[model samples]
Target: MTYAFGDTDLAARRLALLAETFAPSSRTFMVEAAHTGLRLAADLGCGPGYSTHLLAGALEPAHTVGLDNSESFLDLARATASDKVSFCCHDITTGPFPSGPYDLLFSRFELTHLQHPEAVIELWGRQLAVGGRLLMEEVEYIGTTHPVFTSYLEIQQAMLTEQGNSLYIGPVLDAVPDPAALKRRSSNVQTAPIPAERAAAMFRMNLGVWRHNDFVRRTLDPSDLDDLESALAAIESGRSAVSSVEWGLRRVVMDRVDP
Candidate 1:
């Protein structure tokens, strides 16, 4: 399994953005979906555990498990472990789920990386207890008028396609076993403005992540990547002035039906 953007500094920076700009809305959506009586919850692809921690606070699951395939990320999650929250190392696609019949199973931006997301969803659905809910959040599209970000996204999309993954996996949610069980709770295009310095750092980190990848080199124009790198450095060094760096993100939330 090739995770083009694995657990790295770039992933961490992106996680920060998700934590600050995305998770609140997602938590609110899930909370409204199941107002009370949420007992156990699992966060698939929990990464460094931001969403897992958030789920713990929002649902107060009696036992919350943050599952991921990366031991490095699991180590980071375990460091912040609490009585109610724990970390598990397991890939959601093929590995055995830790223990389920859970009150909630949640994942974000994870489906896009998998070749068989529907299969994973079916397996996770079986783990839900009666009346339990499955919630997922994924990017429908990333829109940006910023040239640098747009160019970066283009390359990113190509890289994902090369890896047999889709950066836009929103429509695949419909392929779940019971189409009626998936509810499209929210869909919108919004832009989160990041400080120029922080945005520059994020771009640099991602470029670093992709720079060494053979697929990236073979699939994208080398000169363009170099130009983007230089452009980001200029943006960071005050050679260029950007009023605000924006990320146009679209997200959809799906809820599993009660059985």
Candidate 2:
């Protein structure tokens, strides 16, 4: 499945915010569930290594492998690598998982892009060592009291739905076998308090990524895209008011229990 947001500089910046907003709590939950000691870990769809870096720092694993299909993303990820942190370029869906029997396998916002997420989970289950953990996070829904951001999300969800991905992949976690557990959490990523200039700048950069997406171009109206651009510009210029945008998230932490 194609990523709705291609690997680009703008996409990388957005992902940094996305990870920063959600990954801390995810790490906390994983630590609690896995009981604090991780020897080896794999970060699936590591996406510019934000989450991978987090895992490396928090767990201080003997080895941390960050995997992604995007060469561009991997290139950036590699720049940040240390002796303990390494990056590999490979498709998470079709390629073999990076050499493992890993203590922890983590993915964020990636299941939604996969056609066979359950199969992937099963693969992870097999690769995880006994007492290992599989941690995942995905967008449950995007919400806002603001009208313009709401419209933006509606359009975003429409494109995702058309591509056969769900904005909310939380329910899919239930279908994974026993030993896996799930929880819902608020990302606490607020939109309103953002300065008009910064919000506009961020959304404008986001729009650039959206405009380049093949699925979005094929699915979203050209005029609607133009209108979004104008609206964001207006909000940036203080000509419009929009408030309180946030994304709800679901966190799933599955422990591998050997039968």
Candidate 3:
């Protein structure tokens, strides 16, 4: 699948290919304790309706809003929006987030995609009601310490800096726990490796990012586009020694501490 923008949903689909995808230490991370009692809930950037389905299932007793910027994605959500759930196509970066004193708000592997993740987090925080919970699970690529992945990451870092951009994922993960410049919000941040199976799947799903990151396309292999695709595939293989070492994945759970 192409990761350009609608990649989150594509990645989510690839993750649930197996039955155990969301089984705790599995390919997906979702709360199963039942959210039916929540007065309101939302899964912002609920691409492809994967998480939308999960949220709707859990919040069956309440109205759940699925907000996203892609109409193609919202269409997928509406197909499953029976009665307690509905999809809203919107560019949350601007305009209003649907009305919510929502008791719970979440996004899986979602926040890091924004150029202004901090600002976006602040916005979501604003929509949260008293005693509400805002949780975001993101890729917190802590280190390039893996023996093989370090090279690719180093190259990525330099390439992004040259393009006047940062690597964007891990750094933001580190910042979520600190709400210093954000709107009045108290939060907690935690990180852990997603299951190897799921991690590899998500990375593999976005196999095209190497070409989209500008740094990889313009600097890493500017003269060898074909070689770049080959490398991306290799790194996503999970089993290939070189790929396993080069592509690593993890998730962060950021929660807006309930008052």
Count clashes in each candidate, considering only residues at least 3 apart in sequence or on different chains.
Answer: 0, 0, 3
The full ranking of all candidates by TM-score, starting with the best, is 2, 1, 3
**For model 3, the run of ten residues with the poorest summed lDDT:** 242-251
Write down the lDDT of every candidate, Cα atoms only: 0.73, 0.73, 0.54
Across 119-188, the per-residue lDDT of candidate 1 in tens digits comes to 6776776677655677777766664566886787788788888888888786666444554444445555
Model 1 TM-score (2 dp) = 0.83
Model 2, runs deviating above 4 Å? 175-203, 233-241
Off by over 4 Å in 3: 1-36, 59-61, 142-201, 209-215, 222-259
lDDT of 2 by residue, 1-259 (tens): 6678778888999788766656667667556545555789999999899999888877778899998989999999999999999999878775457687788888878888887677777776777787777777776665555667767767666777877777667666645555343222222221223344445556666787777677677777888888988887888777665563455556667777755
Question: Which candidate would rank higher by TM-score, 2 or 3?
Answer: 2
TM-score of each: 0.83, 0.83, 0.66
lDDT of 3 by residue, 58-117 (tens): 455378888887776666668887677888876666545777656777676555446566
Error of 1 at 109 (Å): 1.2
Model 1 alpha-carbon miss at residue 99, Å = 1.6
Best by TM-score: 2
